[model samples]
Target: MRSRSTLPCCITLLAFALPAQVINKPAQPNKFLEAVGRRAALLGREDGNFEAWVYPIKILRDFQLSVYIDNALEPTPLSGLAETVEVRPGHVTITHVTAAFTVRQTWVASLDKPAVEVLLDIDTSKPLKFRVSFIPEMKPMWPASFGGQSTGWNQKDGVLTFTEGMGRFRPVLGSPRFTRISEQIGHQLPDRTVMIEFEIDRSGRVPIVIAGSRSTYNEIIQDPDALVPAADTFYREFLNRTTSVQAAGLNPSYDWAKIAIEKGWACNDGVGCGLVAGWAPSGLSERPGFGWYFGGDTMMSAWAMQDYGDFAGARAALEFLLDRQRADGKVMHEWTQSSALLDWPKYPYGYYHADTTPLFLFTAARYVRQSGDRDFLQKHWAKLEQAYRFCLTMLDDDGLLSNQKGGAAAVETGALSGKVARDIYLQGVWLGGLAGFADLAGWRGNASLQSEAESRLARAREAIKPWFIQDKGIFAFAQLKDGSRYEANSGWQGFLIANGGIDRALAEKAAASLALPTLATPWGTRMFATDSPFYDPVGYNDGSVWPFVTAQTTLALFRHGQAAAGYRYIYGMAQATGLSGAGFISEYFSGDRFAEGPRAVPHQLFSSVALVHPLISGMLGLDGDAMAGRLTIHPQIPCSLGPVRFERYRVGDAWVSGAIRPAKPTSTVDIEVQGPTLKVVKQPAPCIDLQEVKPLTPGQRGQ
Candidate 1:
């Protein structure tokens, strides 16, 4: 009944009296995070350090945008006190005033190229010595120097070049004549600093281009604005390909959704192009020196892209994996960009994760429903069959999918650390895959195959119930090889069952348990409960919160008659979307403070799509089955949202969009079909009897 920030009556009563001035004001609403350039994928700090990578290539490490005022040769990094504001797209003005002089630095990044532009505007009575520099980490790019090697760089032909065996980047300098030049070579930013001094000219505007490829370099040399359309063209292609959401002014989830999807896209120019897990083209990993392409990440994003009506993006991402599907139907976990290192011809696949295969099937079935791409379906049916067959092979003796024997799971850390046993979550996923596969078989008129998949689903449901749900608990996170249970708070629990099409008991139980703080955070759900022994808020899987997981759980909640709780998770995700990166939803947040953790990827697809998925499938509850030639709508909207609209949302060959709002005593949904209206099913929420249900912990049941 109150605002998101309102304190409970119990908490406010205990607050110590304070001066009127000490009272807190409603926090400033966080604005949308926008790209510096229309399609630029660069982020920075107050310090001069800038991270950039030419898409499809790895991160260009050690390069920075540094400025020196009044010949001091160094300027303090923007203190936390300094207010850095985006003055315009691709430009921000940073004014760090101190006793010495007040300096205004305008930072800019070219919308199309991997470049940073800056001009240090000074206001001082005395002769001011100002310099802007491009610093590079001294080590060569190739044979990556996790060794921390050092090398000095030089300028020739008006271009500053940094090269290593891996690749090369050249900065095309503009306008400013360097009065001084110097370089420091090593691992740290200071060690690799490059000082480029310039005289104060009539127009202080300076332009420099960081050329990633020979074509980009040549285009810039011929016409500095030549590559501008690259970004504009890319934006144009995806801008209209959208499914957006907004709760009036309350949330900016829709504002950041498109950006997050865009961030996940990268092209190699030739190998194959599709939506990636994250655009981690540059920047060393926490371990350093290696980069990878993730299959699980891609699969999750496929549904996200599909939700946005970008069937092409969704299809491309899925097809990319299907192309490399193992002979036995095992989808890969991850792969490197430079496949030469992995012997692509003989060993193109890297299968490790058990969920990827079943997930691939799940997504494949979804694509078929949304696209009615029977041609694509017929082509990949064998591979889909192989995927199903493979899932069966990996069914552990416990009648569940085991990550220890198959692949690294979504949970990468914790107390139930490692063993090749069934995780409660995988059973749900494998179940969903079986059901979906069976449905696909039925559509194809293959009774035998359909029956086979249906039988597997039947077996999975019976076996999974006892393994995961016990002691009147909603769900168990996982089972050890020796049959011991780790009844921890796992955010993925709802998703596992949701995907498997399981019953309402687990759903209702999860909802009741999560109403408290065990799994729920003000931001979203935690990977593991902070109170659990496996809890490590900052640990990758120990206790980090994942937006994508929250999105999946939100959908599960809505379907199982927990729409009230489901909406909270959805809104929490939307609120946290732009917190760290403005418009970008990051990879994961630390479990403790719900803050961004180390190596969290910004504009990550799954995270962005996580919000998108819940809004589409849960709130709108639109189901398009091209094969069945039917559109289903089961809307459950909270009255507080006022009125909501889903514009131009596509389902298979037919296009439909509509609006829904609270009616006299309930909610009413209206649909607009672009083409001839076909069979439409408007379903209502099922009755949920709460007469005997009582509050309970995640690990227990109560009446």
Candidate 2:
């Protein structure tokens, strides 16, 4: 049998060898035309921006478009005055209509280049001029700063080039039909913006190319008519590379989530390459909202990427983080795209999070399990050991992982006050990492290493009971520096259910607490129960409903055999996909209502996991041990989802095609496999074992 590591090469070879018709077709985006005011824009009118795939790409956050009649009138806002908008798979079209003329503009971020292309078609009786404008902010995203940044613009070779900060980023805007090119330089980068104009006649099409470099922009405008179709094809093929879910209400958002994940894969010139956390307009902030490489977010989002057939994407992300893993084994918390331009490491924010290390171990193990990449483990075994060893140094007196020693945790700045000695959330992740490390050790045939991990795993299991506030029927949110418990009904309980080795009864009890009004909301599970004194509906970690957190709780519920409850949360979070953006999910939402939180990102990379992970892992109950050539299919889907057909679901090197038909007592499951032979098991999904359910040690029982 071929190892999953070789699947990517084989798939690429097969793609070239096989006929095109046999390949899966990309999902067709529904044609949508709805009138929306400027406030209803996904990224907000003032802060909205678009980005394209470019090594040294321009951040199009403040970029705008307008039109002028006869080249004599004032440039009218076309985007802000948009009467209807149509968002397709890889492009967005905004339409503006008036008593005299109707204008439709389509924007596409070039799939293979660092250029953003726009196709403008006008239906005006009078001669019109279309304009593209933006102030070049030559600064990379936040946390990485460059001083003396100034904006300069020059027109040469019929293209207008905008330069920023010691000539680091130079972007050009040009069109074959350009009427005029102009710019205004400022003392600093913020005070300047550039404009490109195009002459338009009846139903005339103009292509405007904005690129990271002049040559690239010139090459694009030379054959501007071909950019949009090329971009559309690129996005389609990219989506077709992953699994497709044909469940009635689920496919749209599922496809959207796939796009969001694919878009998250970014590469900076000299900084590094990996999945970014999320992207929003930078606005007044130096950085776009979380628009940089994030180790923790990348690893967590990789779960969903692997769940679908994007194992290559998952592997790429894992390798990116592994390459940058700290010398002492702590995974990075954040890496700004402009790190190469600044003294990034000198800052303390990179390795500030304690949970990122364990998440690395967990995600590495998961990638190997799901992708059957034993060679990856063999190659990076020493680094994995270092990560696990680093985790051990953070243990508190009770044997649970301590946030104080490691770094910032889930509740970094809010919800919990004072120095936290330990938290059940971090401990649960630690338990999961320990289990994962043991698996890695066993895979490497290192019994001693596995034994050591197992030992700590057992000790942590015994120590966790003390944090269970028995009266509240909930796990303590944190153990402060004084070793006193801070009890609160929190969504973090789901972490224990999903990863911590809590007993089935205890997991069920904790999952039940999530059903209470204080913790459960119409949108999803709240970070903290509303009744808690510290709860804040919009607080970063206080009471917001993070879709990723909801995912943990949903999976926990399913792991504890609470499928109905899990489905409810899944359905609720899925609705946000339709609400916030066409197919995008926001970072978090208000715990008290269906609205997204004030600063929630329109498209968060990890937010997709809330749908993809649970829908595949929980509802479909598809777990893979690709290393063992085994896959377990234990569907716990509710009838409410109706019949579901999931195809091209990747399990290591193998592909799974499954159908779930609701029946009286249970759903009938039919699964078909391709690529490699697999031992398909039909049974209940696996859960964490509570250290053989043994009683606690005598010294610890009374605590």
Candidate 3:
């Protein structure tokens, strides 16, 4: 939870503040090949440029075969592999294959394109087997020398070799043989991309003979007469084994969510880390370089663990945050290389913005509930206490948490400059955290803390009302101080409402007002209003429809009893991003009319976690009453998704297994309540009082 005073300079310079035109311009279509599940179609070539829409996914590996004639007898330069060939509308003609092969030449394609189909018509009857050699994209000026040393490359005979120290190259070839090849290719930094070369032998054995990069010194000799086979074993294996989720057909948002999760795991687990932008390491590290602020990684990891019931992963992430808590109960914005607290020059060491603590608290509470590990709470109570105290201290004289620092931008530096205001998003986090705390406290028999948390939550709601309500609708983004408004139609605002911070009436108003045709793209809700000055379909936080935002908003809609609307949004987002073999989700999509965008950036983790909401809230209809350790099971399956079944593990060792099948307009849901099973009562009878739902402690069995 290390907070920084200045927003990461890299984020501003590299991510946000780039020129609008450059950011908004259509992403190069060829880049889509790098993504995993992209469905690339051979859209008729237009004016020499191949046009295609790539369905996004996390790519494990890719290979290409290039065929061309050597026109010049003199040795031609084999440089700039990316720029050498022109991809014409109908077909890409390879003009050269270097000096190695005179009549027939072969090369592996870069993983940057989504789907590539070779147009060559070679005779199948002949023994002249086409060899496709796969090689990682190598750029000049790479294999940088660090620690004042010359990092050189060596090729003895036909074996190309490059060496580096720990925190260097680690190849992930998706197989055991590739691991050895990856070792030969220089060491890889967590965030940096590295290339590996695999040769297809004449006997059709695609053994990766060498997998190292060429040194920048140009001292290493190129391999001549290298054998390349047509069949790429790794890619074929990946394509053959990976199966996409069935939900992908009916829901684009969920599909994207699945893809994002897969990619995040792939990158984090060293499967395909260098491809995606967000999840890839910022530097070399044994652990995936997950940022600490707002417990973003913790929340995402929790979402990822939902399906498999990976309580250990959920616990480890929670522990990571708890271990970093400051004495004053605040989480830091960022951590140093040694895992020490990042001390921002301007901000107090322990001072924090509002969201970090609350997110952590909620996530921690969820872990405890799912695992039924009271011991963990006992061990981390002190840290939780400090966090709660910090949250309570943030409340202003008016009951709402005050942005003592300059809001989100200042949480890092701890400086209170510029606009000294509160934001609705932060408030939502605070209230949500408080709600989680209230639930946890009630479960633990801490009546005092629970009551106090309830009072604080009530005040927060009261305070938020005036600022968001305008023209009988909820404002998109709101400034806390004096109730001024900014960004009238924001998906974030919808998120807060969907999460239960806003009242039902207000939630409905916000949903109705924001669901405009212009603002709601085919993928999901746009990040910004269509009329806003900053709206750009491709720009991050501008108009790009992020699956993460869509997922949260859809969950919020379900919370407000607008389940149909929630289902529609999730369905649309999933459909827009077609499923890939990797089963991961894309980070974002074009908010403009185009169904797709540039696909270079692969799967992300947070986007994938968003997919779980529909499974939990819509398909299973599992709603937890945290205080009572009780869950209400009401299945509301969409018609298109005919039959669905799942098992959900809940608190107190209770398990809820259920199936939902279509019954004309309505669906019939049958749930088998296991563990300390509760009596099944159909809805429309009077709502059950909280006390009536008995709380089950650990080891309790249902009759």
Candidate 4:
């Protein structure tokens, strides 16, 4: 027998270098801003409110306000404030003077539309204050660089500051008596947009500060300690430079929320997934026949697009798989368009396994539902049919798919030789695929095909139940012919429930089993239980924590009325692995701890699968009742979040916007009819009685 230690190497090579820390440039001309503004204006009529900003770091700039007004009797004291001015480099400062106001100013630039940082040190205790206007020049810079690219401005402290190389700059205060009241807030506050009119006092000192504007704070505040030090450093440096002051009008029409979403999705790798985590250490190298197997790297990226309703992305991935399907109907284990061979040694005892086919089927079905594009389905149906036929071929006399050959044997173990085995994972995949096909058939209106699929699926489920049942509930994986049990209890089994292969009761049992400390890990779901005789924390499949499996399992539990448990599992993995902080999911983490491995693979596609599909199916509970031509949804949103909104989504034939609001202990479910005039039902049952709608014409046949 091959020792578990000798697993095949599965590596990844990122196309780009890791992002570097950004160095802020000292006060300088805002060329990038000017360029962006120019571009925006050219694209549309100059609405004056059109604003452009850049961030080398993640920070919320449009939050909070401090306004200073000249209280002089002369009405012109605030005059000419609308003119654009620039702050001299290393000459701006801000100092807190009293609870009511702070001192801030900079040297005015002499040119037209000069870049300037407007400072509003508001007196929280005052009632109403001044009116001032000017083109506010705000520059925010990140502390990191993209390779060796120039560090751009990003929001640092509450105030937007521009950095130049090693120099730090901010609005400076000339007087020492100014008392700066640091908003002792823990997390970075969100940006808000407000419109306020102020009164100038006789002494030229503005007395009141009114909340005026609002906008979204794109910066995500995770760790207070980690962010505060950097903020303080920037603030202190800004206080050292002082000169003049100015005020700018608020831009009300800009939409920051959309910008944030776009930015969040920008990190995606063009190959169908996002790299939420950093690149894998192995570097980019193609498998002998497979184009690229980033392991869980590409897999985890699937979720980043889910919340955004990126059906195009989902379809691209399905098409990739469909195009790569083999003549035998079996999808390649893993391949890139550049390569013809499949890579399967990554998972031992599963060479050209039956599991891959089912995964492909599931993804394809999802694509068809989201797009409602019959052309794509018709084009890929042959591949789909072939794959299903191949799966049928794998079914043993007992009606369960069995693995007749184990994966490549490690060189130390000589040649490979072992009795054929049956993996529970394969069975789960088979069921998932069957269910997916049934869904597709219903969508295509093929009543006969749908019925045939449903029958086959029922038989498949019945054949596996006896061998899977155990005193504890369901066996994780079973033997090929006899009812021998495989000791490996993994989160993958939980996916069967999440994927809708099994009922809620069995899913709950599987989820409960996942809580075992032996199988649980800080990073995510461990591949196998540590207490198992074959367990090895460092072994590839023996004890590794695979994020992809964890995501799938979590989704399953959430769908089965175990939302809290599912959220806990997902949140724990995100926090422990620092994946949430990084704003991305990784392929896998160390089994013993959450530290990322040197061979850490990034941009995994399946890892994000949990992020997207589950939110729709589990959280929102959106599904098609084919026969009724209706859409159903049961939303169970968490308490802390505000109304969950989806911008543009396709349900049947119409596009619609919808929100999910939680109702105390019970979740609120709502579905809006957007497509053709169709039935809308409130019940939470599947459309089992609906007959599949058939194609209207010969061209639509099989589509």
Candidate 5:
């Protein structure tokens, strides 16, 4: 650790680094209205089921939010007859005009409560009856019961409640008498159809409320009287959380990433708050995969949240994970929700991952880098010190992290599980942790630690190539513990590439080998080649396509000067978020070499991280050394997307924003930075309106 006498210097560095210790701008209400989707529409609220998906393109199997008209037997096919499906950040509007009656329905979900509000306007000549239904696939643990029949409520209560295990779903209306029970016989499907009859009485408006509850069962939650106001307040407060960032020259990946981050953002009663990887619907009970708080997820989410100016969420997630670190500096994988601890006996496994601890260090370093919050560093320096020490112990004489060798600790799934060698993925992370430690050490002026970390990083870099790089244009997954090797094209290449400072020819060959059509998907890179004997499209790790890996590779591509290729991967990741209309990236996709995946959670935090990172690190190329009061921007504009602007982007205590307009036929970029105190340390691109940054006054505005 650095000497305590240098504390004042650290404080001075931070004092010049940030505008204020805490941002105190009075946040006025934000009227957020962004329409983003392809086949399905994502309704985002900090409340509700954390997601409400509507399939407007093809309503054959719309997941959560569904609509039915008149005949329950022949339900209305919304996609086939739908005219318009308009989405705003606040609500979703779907209008369908048929030969008989014209139905216009608006779906508004509360951002503050566990409820959805729907307003329907019908225009018909004859008496028409239609029903609106909400069917969620609450898989597993459901030899269940449905209908408005809870402990005290009945069908006469004009509500629909489906309760099983510890969870409940209630869809209520004030003036309707609803009674329907279509329970799943084998619990294979959530076929419990809860519908309220809407008899078209001379084209009038009808309101409906769909409330979903798991642990929240208070008077306000149970009361039908408060649903409307709850929704109204929710929309107002929730809009403030939504931000609009035009990707400029890029595709909708930036927008989708931001949306997905919001979708997967979760908070549980016991575990406090963190980003869940994804919530996949299965035949088994709803399991929050590393949900309560996964160290990896928390670490990765910091990238996305920071890129999108959601530092509060990022900080919350970071603190949540840090609070649960084990004594010996091992960061546990997850701290599950109270429900997981209560409802299931097999969950809350703290250290299922060997990569998580290093990843935690990576995230913390990045947070400090972006936030310039040396104050945070000062507070957590000892924890960081202990973590690095633990890492040193984990390293073998060969410098590889050996704890994950031939165990369930690292690479826990697919064919890689229980392998007899250390995988390259661990090395990639080990390298990242080394880089982070060196950077932090340099910041604190710890000469001995900085020299040691640099030396370790250099030795490992030289050592890995000889052991892992094979002659067949590939990097071996690992050198087996038995002195053999596992030769394969692993997605770990991205991590190695992104860590930078690798041999150019070796890194280039490794990157090109993985880009083969057999292993690359437009959505994400496959974990293994399709021709591999162990390849399974849906295999946990063998052939699965992970969007986060795609993102990591995208950053690596940028580091290797393949910015255009990196942009394509960004497009693929953005498209994956639209698959379920949940605006969340799933855990992994079937490695059929497509961008989309099935059989995974819908909203992996790193999936969003995949997007958040590239926009800043790749495209805009903004690097901030808050400690040195230096900022740099390099333009990596692709020819296809044209010039773009990233407005109102935050950099530590200040906001440095500009547009990337093409300098015409020359293929150069005309970059411009508006007035700000951020001093230029390295700027290759031509910039306009650069200004000298002064220390921020007491009430300067920067959120």
Candidate 6:
């Protein structure tokens, strides 16, 4: 690791290198609001599923605040009761109103403690009592469940404690100063709830805190108010450590994406520490809808993590996956948080995905290229080599990676089923992995290994070319088990092009096909074209619009010089950020509407990355190799975005900040650098000469 003492000297050197006219003021923090009126009252019911992590041990996933005015048994609805919900980085404030009183509840997940705090304030004419319910499901995340689980509860003084799984989940609840408090435990059909009552005079404030550990419980009950502010400070400081974007069209959503990605970072005591797929309320389901450590999802989102300079978090994710690599060198697909209670690895679910291994290699190489962490590469080189060798074993006779060896590819359980022989998506990820391995070998001075990887990559590209059906203007989605082509034009093509390993002509053709209305939706690009035999608007993988897939497709367009066509999808994704949940992106949306499905998660990690990665790599056009000490800027900023500022973006050991103003002849760039010596390169690009880009026409069919 580099010495911290050298930072000042590097900053001094960078100060002299920066342009004289460029100046940057500290960017302001972003906030979001969800107004819950009569018409949009259902929006208030969407749970933020706010979570807190106390490092490598516990995670507190608490439901949204449910208020009960007077003596109502259940939490009241917001049709005419609540006004608005304001969501910030560290906390969420919900304002509930009635004819007799106005109650404001501020919900926070302690950054340093395994607890969640809800600060309550009431405004009324006389002393009145009200109830607030919290269902802290003291259970592990999805895919790992405890059979014959036992539960116990105890109440001492004003604190109520709930325990389960032999003290594995000991949740205690109480307040510091609120004296007039009483508690009740209600046995709901599916989930147990703890209801606390508090009486207030004309105007009073109270704190309702729930903690998972004794240390946290004691700390919170003593200084409950401090936890909320401390969490706010923690988020502000965390944001300072990473990058932020400032532009006209993109504000709060960009910052929201930053928090969305960071919130996915989870650490378990013995299992491992890394990024979970996403989080949602575990209402009646065994899992919180993909709330488990996934190798493919983590590696996929690590690109966005690197885009915003969260190198440490990204590295930790890589280490987490490395610790779980199978004996045969294949990266494990998914590991649940509840593995400690069961024999998880003995099951077949961990290595079910064909793409995770290659993604591991690809993401690792990308991390090193961006952060220039050669020590990491050196330490993990053996495991990475093993993963590369494992990839070689999966290649079919045609040289393309087959999905039938030991794992499934793309569509897991949808209308498109059966064992896939070789899919373009897997081939694209494998090619990227091969390219990454080649680069790593070259860096390690292994010329023979580099040559072998390069030769195999060339062969894979040749194998994939025949899969493209020229008459259809798109590539075959996959080759079936019977050696027949499934020639449905899919958004999966975008995944192949995003890696830049495919032929330029083929990428252009795929990008053009992506523009067809059969695949492109008003919200985002559908996984499958609407006209397909297996098209289902709400199907998980058939026709749903996943933000990550949309992002990859849009990024593919930008990579192949389809800038105008790509901007529409990017804009649609940004808009979707506010459509369902404030400061969050839904996991998937219907191909026909702007809404998410019944079981869709409101705050998804890769869905958030859809906003960050595309804006950085696609719009800002930045590619950095810290080891080479070179930072290249090839911007394709659309005219609709107006002037753009990319602040505090990190390239290896250096902090790069820049401003872009799109123009006809040429776009102007004002950049500043801090930390490390670096060479800046500005590549020539097609001059942008368009006005505000509008949304694409809906319901149009493809040729």
lDDT per residue (tens digit) for residues 647-689 in model 1: 5566776667566665445566666566545478887453222
| Candidate 6 lDDT by residue in tens digits, 131-161 | 5444444445444543323333343445655
lDDT pick, better of 3 and 4: 3
TM per candidate comes to 0.80, 0.87, 0.63, 0.53, 0.74, 0.87
Which tens-of-lDDT digit does each residue in 1-703 have in candidate 3? 1111122223221111111110111123232222121122222111112221121211112243323223333222222122233321122233322234322112222123223232222322212222233323211111112221112223333233322343233211221112112223234322222233323223222222222222311221122112111223323232222211233244333333433443332112111122122332111222122211224544655644544344555565566556666777876443322121213324442233456776667767766765666877878777876788887777777766666542352122111223447666667677777787887787677899989988888887887777655664765464635554464576776546766466778877777655666566545677666776567776665677777677666776655555556665655544434222123355666777433334413345555555665556544556543335576666554555555544343434555544456555456655555567554533311111111112222222212
- Residue 553 of candidate 6: its Cα lDDT? 90
Give residue 506's lDDT in candidate 3 (0 to 100).
80
Off by over 4 Å in 1: 1-43, 46-48, 55-82, 87-156, 165-180, 183-191, 225-237, 269-271, 279-291, 340-349, 397-399, 468-470, 505-507, 514-516, 530-533, 684-703
By summed lDDT, which 10 consecutive residues of candidate 6 come out lowest? 35-44
What TM-score, to 2 decimals, does candidate 4 have?
A: 0.53
Expressed as tens digits, the lDDT of each residue in 1-703 for candidate 4 is: 1101111133221222111222122221211111111001000001111122221121112122234434544323221221222211212222323444433322111111112122333334444343332222222211122221111212222222223333432221111112232222222221232222344332222211111011111121122122223433432332211100010110000011111112222110122322222222111121111114321222233233333345555455455555555667766544332121124334332225456676666666755665566776777677777777777777777666666631211111211124326766667767877888888777667788779878988888877666545575555554634555665576657656666466556667777777666776534567667666566555665666666677776676666655655544544443432132122244556676654433444323344444444545555555643335565666555565434544234443544434455555454434444446545544332211112222122112110
- Per-structure clash totals for the candidates: 10, 2, 52, 74, 8, 1
Total backbone collisions, model 5: 8
lDDT tens digits by residue: candidate 5, 1-703? 1101122222221111111111112111111111122111223222111223211011111222233454456665444455554543345555667777776666554444444445666777777655445444332212222232222234454444344344333322333423443443432334454344445457776655444432332333345345444543443343233323445323344555665566555542333445655544222343433334467776777787776566677777777776777788877676544433343224446665677777667777777887787777788788887888878777778776774431233366656566646777777888888888888877777989989989999988887887445566677777666777777776767887777357778887777766667777666677777776688877877787777777777777666656656666766666555454434556777776343344465556677778778767776676765666666777665554545655445567655545455443433333233334667644444322212222323222211
Q: For residues 51-168, what per-residue lDDT tens digits would candidate 2 score against the true structure?
A: 3223333344456777775455678766545665666666666666766787766766666556666677777787767777776555455555555655444434445555655676
lDDT of 1 at 257: 66
For every candidate structure, what is the RMSD over all alpha carbons to the true structure, in angstroms? Answer: 9.0, 8.6, 14.8, 20.7, 11.3, 6.5
Which candidate tops TM-score? 2
Q: TM-score for candidate 5, please give it.
A: 0.74
